[model samples]
Target: MNFSSKLLENAVAEFARLPGVGQKTALRLVLHLLNQNKQEVEQFSHAITKLRNEIQFCTRCHNISDTSICEICSSHKRDASVICVVEDTRDVMAIENTSQFNGLYHVLGGLISPMDGIGPSDLQVDSLVERLKDGEVREVIFALSATMEGDTTIFYLHKKLKHFNINISTIARGIAFGGELEYVDEITLGRSIVTRVPYENSLTK
Candidate 1:
């Protein structure tokens, strides 16, 4: 197969770099983009560029935001005393879609995966501990995945935060094993929050 166009190859290569996109899918996407009108292509490129340039991480919750603090963190309607800790901004969006949690959030950025070399220090765990120093927070709800890495991170956090009297809880197992909060149904996610268990007693009988 003789490759003719460098531009098309570059576009396919770029698309392939995205997570879960294979060479075939990347080629298909590039062809689809090529079929679109010039104005549509320009708009797509502009949107991608704008997302990279305008969006930033919220200094407080570590969620993607246009400002230092996200709108959720600045909202007076949310309960500042309770923080729902999630693995990523996607999880935060998933929980927000349920509208069941009225508290603030803390995005850990990622989980502790030893095989992937992602340790507790690699995440925003220290920031969470610092946030608790104010004593305004009464609860930290762990909404991480149910995988082994997730369990390990939660246990580490529990031990680190044991000195604080605040309640530490984990979302109920309504979410199946290996289930990601981003993919769980809204009703199941809401139910999980309603039936969350105390983290301290999770390992106990």
Candidate 2:
């Protein structure tokens, strides 16, 4: 697409770099922002800049946060003994929306995808093991997506965690194979969480 101004072209290009955004959508966004007041545009830019500069990952669960610890990790109302393991902050948000779980969460930065060169070392696996060492946790729920990578990650995690006294479980197959937790409906996700089965049980299926 051609833009009359280099500045507008640059802006649209940057916006188009975002996932799922095409050149046309980015151009539309840039035009919309251009239509906004100077103060509003500044505010928009400032918010993005501040987020990139100041956003912190929770020290405990690695969820995105303003402080060292996220509100979910710091909350007394959440079940400290049950930690729901998810792929990222987006999955955490998806699970939270269901209100089916009242537990803490551990966000693995990503799954163990050998094809993508991501392994256990690249994820937050070590910190999770450290969390279990304190003996405060009783159950660890594998809430990863139903993809091959997700299964591989969970299998690796199960091997590392089976020695622990805690119960290891995976969400039920209410979610179809290759389904991502973030894309599933809230009711189905909630039921899956509620009906989670033993990690070993899942292996036999």
Candidate 3:
């Protein structure tokens, strides 16, 4: 797209780099920002800058946080012995919104997708195993999407964690095949968590 100002073009280009954003949408966003008052624009820019510079990942669960540890990991009210394993931070937020789970979480960062070249090593698999080694955890709930990649990741995790004397389960299949937790309705997602099944049982189906 042609632009009268190089600065406006550059701003649009940067915005277009974001996922799901096209050049037109980016340009519209840039134009909208240009219409905003100077103070509002500066505040918006400062907030994004500060977020990028100051956000931290929780060392324990790999969740994005303002501090080294996420509030969920440090909360005394949560069930420390029960850990829900999810594909990413978005899944954590989805589950939290349901208020069905009262346990800690271990974000895998990403699912094991062979086609995408994402393997167990590419994820936070080692850290999850290390967390289990201490034996404070007695149950591990798999709250991944119902896609092939999600199943593969859960299978790999189950193999790695089976030796531990803990209950290994997957959220019940209330979610349709290929459905992501982040997209499922809150009632369905919450019911799935409440009615989880053993990993081995799911294998038979």
User: What overall lDDT goes with each candidate model?
Assistant: 0.91, 0.93, 0.93
Clashing pairs in 3: none
Residue-level lDDT tens digits of model 2 in 1-205? 7679999999999999999999999999999999999999999999999999998999999999988989998998999999999999999999999888999999999999999999899999999999999899999999998889999999999999999999999876687778998999997899788988788866633
lDDT (C-alpha) at residue 18 in model 2: 99
Tens-digit lDDT string for candidate 1 (18-74): 999998899999999999999999999999999998889999999999899899999
- Relative to the unseen true structure, what is the C-alpha lDDT of residue 43 in candidate 2, on a scale of 0 to 100? 100
**Tens digit of per-residue lDDT, candidate 3, span 125-197:** 9999999999899999999998889989999999999999999998867877789889999977897888877
Rank by TM-score (best first) = 2, 3, 1
| Native-to-model Cα distance after best TM-score fit, residue 154 in candidate 3, in Å | 0.6
Model 3: weakest 10-residue lDDT segment is 196-205
TM-score of model 1 vs. true structure: 0.82
Q: Give the TM-score of candidate 3.
A: 0.83
What's the TM for model 2?
Answer: 0.83
